[model samples]
Target: MISKSKVTAKLSVIDRFLPLWIFVAMGLGVALGRVYPAIGPALDAVKVGGVSLPIAIGLFWMMYPVLAKVRYGKLQSVSANGKLFGASLAFNWILGPILMFALAWLLLPDQPHYRTGLILIGLARCIAMVLIWNMLAKGSGEVAALLVALNSVFQILCYSVMGWFFITVVPTWLGAESTEFHVSMWEIAKSVLLFLGLPLVAGALTRVGFVRSRGEEWYEKKFLPKVGPAALLGLLYTIVLMFAMQGDKIVSLPFDVLRIALPLVLYFGIMFTSAFLLSKKLGFSYQETASLSFTAAGNNFELAIAVAIGLFGISSGEALAGVVGPLIEVPALLALVYLSLWLKDRLFPADVRANETAEPKDQATSLAQGGQLR
Candidate 1:
């Protein structure tokens, strides 16, 4: 059995480096965009048979380690945490999109495609990054894993619904042409399966094999450490290609970043605040509340970007918004992680302090007693 203290220590090391890894990836992505436009287009060759697909290479690798560690049985554990589950579902599905729509309308520039792109990005909730947040907050790994699975399901089902609503319904509300709002459900489903589903399945299988063959301890100590850097590198490589492909558009539309940044900031602020309040009212401990808050705040840019490219083409301002979302999100999330630590210290001070020195036998005895009660 993995002790909480050991898990906490390992997470501290990961927390120290995760922000840097994400920023490095973003920088590399930008550099790649600047250097090789054609190379960016070439990287999209991964497809099912001959049909071209929209897979985010970096996102896939980044999620691999987390998926590998997922205990399949944990899915069943979610029922025990219904309030937390309800809170995540409410924020991600209910409040999340509404806030995104409002943010896009209020903050994103007047450009139509760019506005749509921000909406798409916001509609997709964070699947992988939230896990990192949960880990940093010392949340239940089981709850985090369940959220990943739940978000993956919602991303596929709701992407088309939310996309069409934004494109069609929102335009009508603003007295624009609803007739021109066009995105096929088939295309959205295919993109979700190819980019999101494939990586998820691959990661799950990898996790199962690693646990069975090498055992959890070996997998945790040896394999898990390496997965983080590898995923970050993959994301960086993919981001570079994306930036390279869209470098010209990015440079030409200098204010695009400013425009995109607004909706993102608004969305993050609204979602984080809402989740934090709900967690408190629901009486969640500080750690769990932090996990809920960040999970609500983060967006799943990888899925959103893929769908944006598929729907609006890679050069569309919409796709650019999707790309920019992560650039803003990474640093913001790091800040939130620190904020979570601070909040945890204030509200639940016990979480931050080092454990008192205790003999191994005594610790084992305590754990055994607790297990017997359960």
Candidate 2:
């Protein structure tokens, strides 16, 4: 088994200090917003097709690099694992939404707006950040990419219907007051298309184009390293902008934020732990298990925040809850990354050979050698 110190040493400086960097970004964002309140308004004023321009840029920049690292050629191999697909679908769609709804109402019964916001988050399965988390956890990039793409398709199709049901219909079934929530399908579609579709196409095209022209050797070795660091940079950039825009709310409403954060924390913990255990139980390798866990644990906070802001207004508790999703998720998932590695050493030791067989050597080695796995 790889020692803890050895695994830690294998991570790049950026990966090693990811939590520290994210916290620093959050602090810097809060400071920027606190010092320059107008910054938020100015940023809000510049919209790209009704989405904040800065945020759109950050999301694109953040997702593109990670997506570019996906081994699209190996997708068939990942997809052939029907068990993995079915299990992922069940965890992300069925268990995930129900769990979040239970947590939201159970934890924040008094805060309807916040409860609704959390439900929206639950409906929006992750597309973007799962790749980064999967990569960091030394999971299968191919599986991560495929699962993310699958979730995006599901997100585009079911998000609105599920949002209405969870926030509106389910409450009445449970003898509570049903909230009236309406969201435009086009809006959800637009967000998915822009945030997920654009980067995905770019990434796939880049891989296909580069690998075909430059040969696999040059593309993996020379090109990927240049692009790998950008994923971290864009992630930090997105976090800063997100926090900066809502820094006032986060700073002033500490107690309320904490109230909203509690359910989200519970949601992430339960989702990740359950997924990890179930995946392992199902006989998946550590790599596939990590991919499934992160995908199951993460949410499309961008979509949740946008929908909440549009429907409930930026200053509403719903929006505040949506904003808090990533604040909690970033740290929560980072902790899970380490937890996954630790678990790998203990629970997944027997499956190491399976994982090595499932994953390409260069891909697995890249994580230890400062290259992003593809």
Which candidate achieves the best TM-score against the true structure?
2
Looking at model 2, residue 215 earns an lDDT score of 92
* Runs with alpha carbons beyond 4 Å of true place in candidate 2: 1-12, 351-374
Q: lDDT tens digits, residues 27-108, model 1?
A: 6666666676665557566654112233354556655655555566666755578888888999988888888887777775
Pull out the clashing pairs in model 1: 29-239, 29-240, 33-243, 33-244, 58-234, 58-235
Candidate 1's C-alpha runs over 4 A off are 1-18, 45-55, 182-218, 221-229, 232-239, 353-374
Worst 10 residues of 2 by lDDT: 365-374
| lDDT scores in order | 0.65, 0.84
Poorest 10 consecutive residues by lDDT, candidate 1: 365-374
Clashes of each: 6, 0
Against the true structure, whose lDDT is highest?
2
